[model samples]
Target: MLLQETAGSDETLSLMQLDLDDFKPVNDTLGHPAGDKLLQFAARRIQDCLTSDDRAYRLAGDEFTVISRGSGHPAKAHRLAEALVAAFKKPFTIDGIAVFVGTSIGISTAPPDGTNPEQLMKASDLALYAAKQDGRGRAKAFDAAMLELLEQRELLRRSLRMALDQQQFFVEYQPLAEGSRIVGFEALLRWHHPLLGKIPPAAFIPMAEADGMMPDIGAWVLEQACREAMKWPENYIVAVNVSAAEFLTSGLTDRISQTLDLVGLPPERLELEITESVLLERTVNNIDTLNTLNVLGIRISLDDFGTEYSSLSYLKTFPFDTIKIDKYFITDLETDPKSQTIVRCVVNLAHGLDMQVTAEGVETPAQAEWLHSVGCDRLQGYLVSRPLPVEAIGEFIDRAETSVSHALV
Candidate 1:
C-alpha cells in the first residue's frame, strides 16, 4: 500500500511530494462534525487536483497529505494547490450550513528528497509547516529552520491542553462607569502561568484555537466570570469577552445560557464584549448566534470600536447597545488635540445610533475631564482603579462608600 504511493516521478513522486499543501483550521468553533466534513472535502479536492493514481491521507485532526507524481513547473504544482485553496476561500456550504475554512500547503520531490515514504513525507511536512507558520491559506517549499519551529510549536501546543482545566488562569474585572457610578465590569482573561509569570492572550488564545481547546476554554471563562459576578451587588454587571470562535462552536450559545441558569444570574447582569472583527463578513450561523444572544436580553458591547476597517455598514447591522472607544484614543486625548476631536465625534455618532459610548483607559484627571466634557457616558481606567480580585473590589467599594458617607455627615 505504501510502496504504490512512493514510486511516481521527478516532479510528482508517489508518497514523496506533498499535494494539497494547505493546513485547514480544525476550529472547536465549527465543532467536530463540520471539521470532519471539511477535512474530507480538503482530501477530495487535493486528490482531484492530481492524477487518478494519487491517494490522500489524514495525519491527524486537521492535517492532510496527498501523494501525486509529476515534474511540472514547481509553479504549476503551486498553481494547482492555489486553485484548491481558492475554492476554499469562498465559504463552504455543507449540509445546508454555510461556513468558511482556510488552509496552507507545502510540497516536496522524490528520490533526491527521499525514495522511502516516511523520508519523503517528512521533507514535505517540514515545507508545509513552514507554509502554515508564514500564515494559513498559503504554500511554501521545504526548509530546515521551519522543521525545528514545528517541533517547538508541538511542545507548546501540548502544554496548553490542560491550561484552563488546571486552574492556571483567572479574570480581572475593569470598572466602567456612568459618571461617578459604576455601571459594569469588563472581564479580562489572565493566564498566570507558574513558570512564566504572565502569558499574553495574544500568545495563547490563537494557540488554544489552533489546538482545538477554545470552546472548552472559552466556556470555562464564561461560567467562572458569571459565578463571580453573581456574588457582586445586583446593580453591577459583568462583561464576558467573546471570541469569534464562539459562533463556529455549535453548542456555545446553549452552553452560555445553561451557565447563566446554573448560577441563577439575570441575563441583563451579563454583557458579552466582542470586537468588530468578529462581526465583519461573518458566516450566517455566527450572525445568528449574535442575534440569539441579543434576544436573550444580555448587553452586547462592541469593544475596541474603530480599530479595524469594518465600516459603518457592519456597525448599523448589529443590535449592539454599547460601543467602547478604544484606549488609544482616550490615552492621547489630554495632549493630542486631534484625539479629543475624534472622541467628540465618536460620542456624537454613538449617541446618534442610540448606543451608549464608554471611554476605556482613562489614566489621568485631564483625560477624564475631556471625555466627560465631550459627553462621554462612561469612563474606565487605572485612574478609576485597576482591576482587582472579587474580594479586593468589595473592600475597595466599601472604603469608597464610607468616604462618601463621611462627607455627607
Candidate 2:
C-alpha cells in the first residue's frame, strides 16, 4: 500500500534488505533466548540509524527491511545500509557476554528498480545474495546483471539435481607425494554438464551443499573412490574431502563404514579431509563424531589449514591426524620470506602435536625441497600430477613409481 501510494506521486522510495552474518553460531552456542535478545539490540541499533521518513520492519529471522521515502533515495539507501553494516561492527553484549555479528545489505530503488512490492523485494533479495557472495558484511545495489546471474544459477541448480542420475559426475584423484614417492591420492569431485561442458567444483559444490545434496553426492563419491582404491597398492591411501554438512550429518560414520565394507577396502586405507568450518560450532556432537571416526581407524585430516582465524585453537581441540597447509601460503614460498616462515612454523607446530603436515600447491621442486627440509610430511600440487580420471590413475601411478626408482638410483 505504501509502495502503491508512492507510485502515484513524484516521490522516490528505496527498500533495503539486511541480513545478519554469522548469526546462527550465536543462536547455536548461546541459545534462542540470547539470539532474540541480540536481535532486539540489533533492531534498536538499526532504529537509531533511521530518520523519521524511514521505517524498519523485521522481515524474518535475522532479516530486516527498511522503507525509505525522500528525494535522494539511492544516496539515502546507501547511507542507511552503510550505517547498519557499521553498527554491527560493535559487539552486542548479551548477559555480559560480548558477541559480534556483521550485516549484509541489498538496496533497490522505487521508480527505477521496481514500483510494486513483489518486484522490489525480489530485486533487493537478489542484491543481498550478491552481497553475501562477494564476501559478506557489505552492500549491493540491484542491477540487470544480477538477474542474469540468478537465471544462470537457477539453471545450474536444476541441472545439478539431475547430474548424478545422468552419470555426469565423476571423481578425479590427485597424487599426494612424500618426497619423490606417491603415498596417497586425494579424491576430487568433477562435473561434466551435457550442455554447459565442464563445471568447476568451486562453482557448483557450494550450490549442492546449500540445496542439501551433498550427503547423497558425498556418499556416492566415497563408494566410488573406495572401489577404485581397492585396485591401488595396499599402502597407497585415498583421501576424500568431506563438506561440513556431510561431516555433521547423522550416521555419516556408518555410511562410510558401509561404503568401505561394500567396496572391500580397509578403513586404514582411507582418509577423510575436512576444513575448519566443520569445527567452528565446537559442539560436543561434532567431537563425538570425530571420535567415532577415529575409532573406526579412518585417518581424519584438517584440510586447507591456517586459513581461518581460529586455526591454532582448532588444532588444540580436534584430534586431526594431518594438517594440510592452504595453497595461498605455499604459492609464495619461493619468493616471500613471510610465507617460508609461516609454512615452517606450521610444519613445526603440527610435528609438535604429533600430527603430520602436508604442503598444498607445491608446484616447483624448490618448494618441495624446502618443504622436505622443514620436515613437511607430504606434498600435493600440479608439480606431481594433475587430478586424473579413474582410468588414468593406474598408468600414472606406474610411471610415478618408475620415476621415483630412477631418481633413487
Tens-digit lDDT string for candidate 2 (1-409): 5766777567899999999998987897679999999999999999999999899999899999999987787988998889888989999999999998999999999878987888899999999999999999999999989999999999999999999999999999999988669998999999999999999999999999999999999999999999889899999999999999888888998999888888899999999999978886646888888888889999999998877544476777777899999999999899999999999998998899999988888787778778878899988988887889889988888899776434322
Candidate 2, residue 143: Cα displacement in angstroms equals 1.1
Q: Per-residue CA lDDT of candidate 1, range 1-409, in tens?
A: 5544445543445342333332232334445687678767766666766656456677766666766545554455566666656766776666777666666777765665666667667887787766665766776766566667777667666767867778988888877667767766788888877775677888788888776787888888898899888877899889888876764778777898999999999999998888876754345766687789888888888989877543686567788888889998887787898888888988999999999998888877777777778788888888777887766777766564443223222
Worst 10 residues of 2 by lDDT: 400-409
Give per-residue lDDT, candidate 1, residue 17. Answer: 34
Worst 10 residues of 1 by lDDT: 16-25
Clashes of 1: 17
Q: Which candidate is the best by lDDT?
A: 2
Cα lDDT for residue 193, candidate 1: 71
